[model samples]
Target: MGCVSRRTQCAPRDTRFPRSQLLQELARYTWPGNVRELRNIVERLLLLTGDAIDAATVRQVLPGRRPSTSGEAGSGTLANRVATFERDVVLQELAAHGHRVTETARALGLERSHLYKKCQQLGIDLKTERTQP
Candidate 1:
């Protein structure tokens, strides 16, 4: 067997698709479901698309999703904005993994303890806060 990086192992194998361009478009998306969402999209594309998976196909499949922009709707310092984004990502990941710290951390490529520290810094009370659907 050939050695494959974790990211490459996770992607679907479809030779007909413009893999690089598809990857670029996927990189632009803010996957709310994180790795799970990425896996689902790749699987869907493999099963649904024909000759090539283009940017238009990706957009059509992922409705209402837009590329992440630096200028969000808020008046805050750069640090504050970064923190807010981090907090949101953590919350979403936690919810996606049913608030399982280890799973969330692994999915995010972070250590479990580091994830806890980040959650604390973001004022996310995992014990008290319910996961959003």
Candidate 2:
């Protein structure tokens, strides 16, 4: 998050794009085109938006698309937003590695113990997730 702020500091003056909201919108989007298309969209966003770029700006930049409101971003306190993002990322990594705690921890650059603690904190039922199809 700090890194995102640092990078966006170099953006056009007064640009107020929040990284979590932006990331939420991006993740919800289904890119029909490839990396080049993503680059173009980002460039377009930078060029088109004024002082602040929030969810509405993102919607305008990507026409005909309505981002889901079910996402955990853009409607909470900062800590809740961060927790939601962390939970999603950890869940994804765990699923990707077939719920192997050590593998998931290594993939996320976390110690196995830390991952377990995180899962516990996030209320992620590993046994339940693992048992699911």
Candidate 3:
């Protein structure tokens, strides 16, 4: 399962703020589909916002409030971080192949063997999903 390509904008982070501070901006983050998706968001934010950007600015642009799988209402944990990454990868692949495994592997520049390996590592089950028409 993949996405139809679309363009959207996201907010910037404050450089004067510490990394920990940005982490506090959890309320500001949108769960973008993939690493590329998230990177694009961060890049847009870095380019558009100045040194003092904060959470309020982020909330304005990001769709839906950031969900708190964080357990502590903003405390991002190691498990949560891993899950986010896995979700993104699955979404990215789903988008690329029009939701077809053979197509998705090619789109990702991966061989069938490697793709299967990745699916195993990422815990994605292609069989459960309906293929693209």
Candidate 4:
């Protein structure tokens, strides 16, 4: 049921992003719908943006949500912090490789299947992600 199984051709390889800044901006948003909403937003951004998706674009697309503060209550919970870090790492790597599973796996020193499972666990939709370019 994932995006990978449905696409006929490979995704384009020219996508570019201001990786760290964008990731920081995204981390600041408190996603009300959690992973699904995040995935949808990522898909939309990839589809709509011309060359890169910046903090300004993200701010324009998702207004009204406040950026998270490090001092906020419960922000230090170990489980939450770990999960957030894991998601960020996976997403950054995926973006770095243009969401190509094989390339990403090689970069991460993981098997393609293991990377896919990891992405699923991290709530990333590889299919939608791979279509970015």
The TM-score leader among the candidates is 2
Total clashes, candidate 2?
0
- Please give the range of 10 consecutive residues that has the lowest summed lDDT in model 1: 1-10
Clashes of 4: 0
Misplaced by over 4 Å in model 2 are 1-73
lDDT of 2 by residue, 3-88 (tens): 33444666867666777887677667787877666666666666544345576656645644734334542688778766875777
RMSD of 1: 11.3
RMSD after Cα superposition, model 2: 12.6
TM-score of each: 0.48, 0.49, 0.38, 0.43
lDDT of 3 at 40: 59
Worst 10 residues of 3 by lDDT: 1-10
> Candidate 4 residues 1-133, lDDT tens each?
1321122112345656676766677678877775666666666556545445677656645646523434573467798766765666577667867877887787566899999898888788888887876
Number of the top candidate by lDDT?
A: 2
A best-first ranking of the candidates according to their lDDT comes to 2, 1, 4, 3
Q: Cα deviation in Å at residue 124, candidate 1? A: 0.5
Model 4: per-residue Cα lDDT at residue 56 = 65
Considering lDDT, which of the candidate structures 2 and 3 is the better prediction for this target?
2
Q: What is the C-alpha lDDT of each candidate?
A: 0.66, 0.69, 0.52, 0.64
Q: In candidate 1, which residue pairs clash?
A: none
lDDT of 2 at 59: 68
Candidate 1, residue 74: lDDT: 50
Where model 4 places Cα greater than 4 Å from the true spot, the runs are 1-76
